[model samples]
Target: MGNQTEVTEFIILGLSNDPQLQIFLFLVFLLVYLITLLSNLVIMVVIRADPHLHTPMYFFLSHLSFVDICYASTVEPKMLVHFLAEHKTISVNSCIAQMFFILQLATTEIFILSAMAYDRYTAICDPLRYMERMSKEICVQLVSGAWAIGFFHALLNTVFALKLHFCGPSQINHFSCELPPLLQLSCTESLTNQVVLLTSAVIFASSSFLLTLISYIHIISTVLRIHSAEGRRKVFSTCSSHLIVVGLFYLTGFLQYTKPSSVSSVVLDEMFSIQYSILTPMLNPIIYSLKNKEVKTAVGKMFQKFKFLK
Candidate 1:
């Protein structure tokens, strides 16, 4: 990959072909994006205004909302625009930048999920010591660790992308600069890139998934040990949202990346990617917050306060 081979820009063949479908998809995705933004923003505002929501659980919840805001924002807006556009193409640098941010937030979401799991772990497995254990200092550390993990994932992935020499067909048959789509457009041999990326993804994904799984297992076990059905329900209620979220995130993501790179159906790939990326992120703030009585109560209180101030 010399200067001559270095790609200055990339072309993105966005979502679909039919103009009618483009308008329809655009409206649908636009609605999804706005709701995602609004929902996440409401979560943040509610969390900040309510002193009771300033605890460890709400602390993690707030961050999860923030992450979902960013995670969904990164792709959906562009995707909406791409739907209605004729020449659905993105510059090479822009594509790379998009890829970087998407991967970063995605990786961050993984670790953040792990941190949330740990919070549940402490809340259930070590109830008496929960507050003392998951203090402010620990919260900061967990958030920091999440960012660090995401950065490294993005950094390595970017390096691999940079190493890839794009010498031929410049059109990316997807809406954004996703890993598989980007790799497909590269002219040079990408054996090394594939190997490195696959290994990294497996290790990171496996470790994070296992950690979350173990945390859930411990939480469920503790719930079972509690004699009262209501006691078990109380504990389960706190963690059930997180379990649903993590399951959706990991499973859809795994479906996108774990497949052999040689599989080249752009439509199928883009469809799966959209599910994991846009739909999943948008779902988090809505699903996680709506399903929980605590968050609903917090939001209701915050809304009442807002009305009083008005």
Candidate 2:
């Protein structure tokens, strides 16, 4: 420990090492980042501009869009820059900050999805009292609570991360400054950090996933009670967008974090990371706008308004 020089910056081994491949990957990821920003911004703008989208569902969707934007923004810009740079390196402080926001925004998104599930449960199971059950105040509280929990969880992990001493290899195998990879490079023991990470994953992430699952179970049961297939389809359509988004998020995230080190590789890690962090944000608005008639209508109206102003 006395002779070890602490690493001040980490060299990120990005997705590709081939110069031509790197340029190609840069173009592809730049396009993805642009779409993520544009699509999420559109979702937010349409929700805000349309009066009909002022309900609890759209309110939650708007926040989800915002989270997706922040989530993608946290990693994509740096990643894009690294893709083209001669030396793909990030300072220790920048890396930690990136990890912090990634954790916070990702955690916040998980809870927000749970809240959306709950909203659907209430809307479908008790339609008459849907508005009352998911009142504006309650919606605000739920969103606020998600953010607060995310902040707390991220801070806890980040504080422990700050205590770690990195005196070993300065090259990160992947593109971003994720906690697990950082732990692998630490000179000091990372048992406590790993324990805290696992504990928080169970407490924050697993709990939220369970809540969402329970909500869907109730929603499905309630839908089954409806007599007509058409009625059931209509009912399911309302929450289908949320369901799809949740599946994409959890599926990729689970594969990324839970996989054994023996089977995990740099390419697989980068692919999973791209899915949940980069591509999912771009896909969310497209899914909602395509699968949801209301959103499509709202977007149409918004475009018409723009044309009218022009």
Compare the candidates by lDDT and give the number of the best one: 2
Task: Score residue 228 of candidate 2 by CA lDDT.
Answer: 100
lDDT of each: 0.82, 0.90
Error of 2 at 75 (Å): 0.3
TM-score of 1: 0.94
Alpha-carbon shift of residue 272 in model 1 (angstroms): 2.0
> Runs in model 1 with CA error above 4 Å?
1-7, 262-264
What is candidate 2's lDDT per residue for 128-221, written digit by digit as tens? 9998999999999999999999999899999999999998699999889888888889999998998888788778878999999999999999
TM-score of each model, in listed order? 0.94, 0.98
Q: What's model 2's TM-score?
A: 0.98
Q: What is candidate 2's local distance difference test score? A: 0.90
Q: What's model 1's overall lDDT?
A: 0.82
Model 1 Cα lDDT, one tens digit per residue, 11-126: 66677778898899888888888888898898888888878778887787788788888888778877777786665667777788888888888888888899899988998899
- Number of clashes in every candidate structure? 4, 0
